[model samples]
Target: MSSKEVDVQQVLNTVGEPTRFRIIELLSSRPHAVGEVATALGALQPQITKHLQALEAAGVIRVHRLGRRRVARLDRETLARVAAYLGGLARADEDDAALDDYQRAIAREETRLAEGDSTRVLRFERDLPADARSVWEAWTNPARAAQWWAPRHFSVRVFDFEPRAGASIRIVLAEGDAEYESRGHVERVGAGRLVFSLAPVDPAGEPLFEARHDLVVTGEDRAHVRLDIEISAVREDAAPAVAGLRPGWEQLLDALDAFLRTTP
Candidate 1:
């Protein structure tokens, strides 16, 4: 029979049971009658017999008449097919490490969350299609920055974004009918590096948290960018923003990556 023809889910569901798993383990060594299995497990014959019937119906085991008694053994074909299916999942895929990092960050933040005034650090790295100069320009240039600074489905309004030290910065991102205003200033700017801080307020004009961002861009032809961000002064009302930090940054990076690919 073909691989697709195997009832892998049924077999898995049947063997997933604790008692049935032990029964399969017992049968793996050799064929066992219901009474013998019951004796080995210290279980009643009726319970063992019922389990055997389920295993057989699910193609996890095969039962046959042996000397006026039923004997059960592992159905090797069905199990081997399941093993093959599981083995296929071990193959590698692109961006898997990024996905794993995001998952780990989520777990770590969940464990570290507390009541008030919490702080969180986020690190993000990406290799882009554009050169370091172009990438830096995209950040420093107000028009270029406006094109890609916001996440998907959001519009950006930049009040001011001067790259020099102590330059005041203000930008607002809007989604649907709501807007989040980011008010801060550029702290330092040098060759392919920028340090800035943003204190974003929610739609209701309530202060959430202040995020300090340190960004570095390097390489030629292909740029490698790193962002180290510290989110601090978290308020009680900003828990939802903290929870969505990873996914939200992922979307913004996605927007940047897309913008770089299409730009000169």
Candidate 2:
């Protein structure tokens, strides 16, 4: 029979037989010759051979010739396939449970929002270069933002960017051949504070999140300025994104600091 015609359930059923089950139980501990299997089960060699043949045909056990002796062992690939199938089924069940929980949370949040409840806010703060205009221009200028905005593995592509309020900006990040885009409108712009709302350009981008940034110029020199920043975003699950942002933001700020120190 073709391998596809050999049903996994049929193999399981064949191995479930009393004699075959005992043989499998014995082999579970260790591989053994047909004679050893017979001796362990207190059966004749021929009787063990019959069960062994059936198991081998069902792809449950494999027999290898060793000189004058034949050794049998469980077919590891078949056993692994069975285990993986069961694991996938369990994962599917767990996903169903999580989906139900998410649906309930959404319904509860909707009811709360209908009553005009506000969103939960998560916050972060940082210190930047001492130059106010430099920090402002670094953040507002597409060229400067592109230099340090993205993570190490990503490069930014800013197609349309205007620092003025109500202008639209589209930023694309490229990682190898994979790309992610953020599309949003500039909501507010102050002396050193900028607020925006960004949504992923594609359906595959992360769910809705908000970006709020506040840059405060702390001090200045003839050609240098000190600035501090408070960047806050509301993400679906803030923990992982927050953790990732910590390092990325630090690196970007470091790059910006270096750029300002050397730039004329």
Best by lDDT: 1
- lDDT score of model 1? 0.82
Give the clash count for each candidate.
0, 6
Q: What is the C-alpha RMSD of each candidate to the true structure, in Å?
A: 7.1, 10.5
How accurate locally, in lDDT, is each candidate? 0.82, 0.67
**lDDT tens digits, residue span 1-264, model 2:** 344645678688888899999998889988999899999999999989999999999888999999999999998777677666667777756446544755665655556445554254434454554456777787788777777677666778664678889998787778899887777777777766677655453365553445444444434542232222232333434333323344545556667777777775
For all predicted structures, in order, the TM-scores are: 0.56, 0.44
For model 1 the TM-score comes to 0.56
| Deviation of model 1 at 256, angstroms | 1.2
